[model samples]
Target: MSPIPTGRLFRTGTGSDLVLSRTFRASAEDVWASLTETERTARWFGPWEGDAAPGRTVRVQMAFEEGTPWCDLRIEACDPPRRLALSMIDESGAWHLELLLAEADGSTELRLVQHLTTEDGLGETGSGWEYYLDLLVASREGGPRPDFDDYHPAMKAYFEELPARAETPGHVR
Candidate 1:
């Protein structure tokens, strides 16, 4: 298997975003269920419960975290089998995230983008996403969950070194 993939950073008028993606040899519908279904998600990221709809809030358990803390997550958008956008606020501050799915030739690619208020915590944030996303892959593939240690401090420098994206008058450079 390949190592964790690297993400590209982009600067927008509101803030910057760090985008990472993983490809799965499954249909978009299957991948979408793995992302949105409570039981499916529990096998990977965590489980969530509450009225699920655009603008509604749900409580999600960070199962892999030290204390398995529960956090409130708001659903911003939910276009099944294609895209889902959500946000959360915790001790770390507000986080806006989007998951986009594209399928081709019987495979689906999941692109996860986290809107950043600042580039300050890219190292920690990027590593956390990498680990969780990989866990999603393992869960879908029926493989064992990977150790977080393999992604953190070890992958810190790589994330820290990602270039800052600057936009020109008409386009991003």
Candidate 2:
């Protein structure tokens, strides 16, 4: 069975945001470590090295991507254990992403928003984030990582239709 796509696209005056969230039964500080600390991140997304502060640039290894490419990512903003914003430009184009963390009742919710100038390749982009985020979850829980094949083509159609579905009356945003 295919994994269900959980990302939602919200339109804005300038463009749109592709948002996906994951809930963890861990403290915000712990989740923040999984996102920020290089050693922890290496297990899920990839390891990053540099000064790592707002306005600083870091070299990150896309450990899961083809060829395991390296890219320079700039830290747009960082509010420890709460919010982080980053931007990078590569052969694929520019990527602007933000993560917001909220904690309540001993659980933390990590909300990821990708600011997009256009909805051109959401099918591919959306599935990619889903796979990475799930990898984060699996890393934390000591579970098996998700297969990309179970995400990409399987969930592509759902993401491709989100813009149209969001336009329909009574559609939940």
Go through the candidates in order and give each one's C-alpha lDDT. Answer: 0.86, 0.90
**Residue-level lDDT tens digits of model 2 in 24-128:** 999999999999999999998899999999999999999889898889999999999999999999987899999899999999999998888989988999999
> How far is 9's C-alpha from truth in model 1 (Å)?
0.8
Candidate 1, residue 96: lDDT:
91
Predicted structure 1: lDDT: 0.86
lDDT of 1 by residue, 55-93 (tens): 999999999999999999999999998989999999988
- Candidate with top TM-score is 2
- Give the TM-scores of the predictions, in the order they appear: 0.92, 0.95
Q: Which lDDT value does model 1 have at 112?
A: 95
Model 2: CA > 4 A from native:
167-173
